[model samples]
Target: MKNLFHSYFESFKGLRKEIWLLSLITLINRAGTMVIPFLSLYLTKNRGFSLEEVGWILTFFGLGSVTGSWLGGKLTDKIGHYRTMVISLLLSSVFFILLQFPSSFWAICLGIYLVMTVADIFRPAVFVAISAYSKPENRTRSITLIRLAINLGFSAGPAIGGLIIATAGYSGLFWVDGITCFLAGILLLKLLHPKRAKTEMEDTFIQAKSAMSDKPYLLFILAMVLFGFIFIQYFSTMPLYYSEYHKLNEMQIGLLLGLNGLLIFLFEMPLIKFLESRRHTATGYLILGTFLTGISFLAINLSDWAGILVVGMLLVTIGEMIGFPFSNSFALNRSDGKKRGSYMALYSISFSISHIFGHNSGMQLINRFGYEFTWYLMLGFALLACLLLFILKKILLRENV
Candidate 1:
């Protein structure tokens, strides 16, 4: 038992200090991620928007995400990841604060679009930073470490967000979100020196290939879009289901969402370490993860017991723990040294594209057919993603041979 516990901590050993700092910045920023999780509820309960209107707003949010990711990639290539991340963090803070002022449907839609566009630019920039900071051998573990920070923050964010909403109203979420972003930016400046990061990256620079020309990678991105489409429902429409079908309150919903993050934080790194040491193919893990996620949705419809919510959430969290870190490492590995910014941008864009259609469509389906039908439909999408990933694995193997 002592040896087993020692092995768990050993998994985190040998990662660069820069990677730790980067994770710290991510933690600070994501810990204030109170607004997005509750955005649908705020629209429905406080702003009095219909589900359709909220869906439209979410679509715009996605559009902005796509734009931000692409722009961040371009900017990261031009100005370096340091500048891109710093700019994104500070600018997004302002936009988050401004988001609270929009009262009308169109205005709120526009506000959300702007906020997300500035905010999501952080994604690609941070990916490039992770690639620049970590050793090749430990890159997967580094990705897992960063994800750990994100889920840890997520664990705290929603629970605290629920309290803030209950006590101070939805407007309080925005203030906290903005302030945290600003604080994270300040911490990044204080801790990570740009010259050192650039020096590290310069040592490994190579002639870059355009990410668009990479067909296999693009196909992989498609599967990610599908995976993200199904996964995103947890944040977007599933909360509504919890409220309407399970009669869960805001605090209860927050706790449930926090549970997903908490589980991932506790288990994901050691799991990734065990999987990585086995040297299994990335797609193999991806297939299992996708299947688990699909089954999680089905679990929701299995019983009327509120305990089923916990069951479903556990499955989703497990799938995420299995899939996401390897996905990051795979995408990074596929990229050439210098143009990694562009490659990671496309990877981030896959999820953004999922957001474009996933949230609105899930809400529309729920509005039309109800939550149970939507859950079944999500299972179908997850299965489809698994099929695509299987095909991708075959193609990749053929290329290697």
Candidate 2:
């Protein structure tokens, strides 16, 4: 038993100190992630916006994210990941604070777009920082650790945000979120320094135009986009589902969503560590994981009970555990070593694209058809993603062969 415990922790061994610090920064920032998780509820319940309006606002937010992701890639390669992350983090804090002042529908929509654009630019920088700090063997585990921190913080955010909302309301939530982002930025600025040598520094001058030309990478991005489209339903629609259909309160909704992060914290690291040496490839994990993610939502359609929601969320969390780290590894491997930021940014754009389509289409479906139909449609999409990923795996193998 002791040996097993030790072996489980062995996966964490030898990772750079910067990786751990990066994870800390992620934890602190995500713990204050109050706005996005509850944005629909805030708009509909607090501000009295229609569901369709909320969808449009979210779409606008996604549009900015897509733009930020593209620009972030260009800047990361031009300046450096450290400066890019610091700038994004600090500017994001400003945007989050600015977000609270807008009351009109158009103003709120515009606010959301600006906030997301500045905030999301840090994503690729975070990926690049992880790649820069870790050794090859430790790369996948390093990314997992960062994600683990994010989930841990997410678990705290909604649970605590529920309390704050009940006591102080949405304005308090905004202040807390903005404050945490600022704190994270300050900490990152003080701790993270660029460690690249002269050769690595010169390599940054190399253009990332090559990544745009890679057909296999482009295909993989498409598959990731589909997975993202299905996965984002959790954020974009699930809260509304729990509230509208299940008639759950804010506290209950928060706890239900918090369960996702808690399950990831408890199970993901140990499971991944145990499986790391089983000779599994990222492709296999992606295929199995994407399929399970599909089945998770389908399970939701089988029952209306809250316990069933937990079970479905558990499946989703497990699938995330298997898929996400591998996806990061795959993206890193497929890109030029010096231009990781550009490749990862392109990869990050997949989520932004999904956000643009998923929220708008999901709410439209719910408004027109109902929630169950939305779930069914997403299930079909997930299955299609699985087929594409399978094809991707075959192509990858053929290229290697």
Task: Note the Cα lDDT for every prediction shown.
Answer: 0.87, 0.83
- Return the lDDT, model 1, position 320: 92
lDDT per residue as tens, model 1, 352-371: 88878887789789999998
Screening candidate 2 with a backbone cut-off below 3 angstroms (N, C-alpha, C), the clashing residue pairs are none
The lDDT leader among the candidates is 1
- Give the lDDT of residue 244 in candidate 2: 92
Clashes of each: 0, 0
lDDT of 2 by residue, 231-337 (tens): 88897688899889889899998788777777777667777766677878887888888888999989989997778888888888888888898888888767655
lDDT of 1 at 273: 83
Native-vs-model 2 lDDT? 0.83
Q: Give the per-residue Cα lDDT of candidate 2 at 131.
A: 74
- Poorest lDDT segment (10 consecutive residues) of candidate 1: 199-208
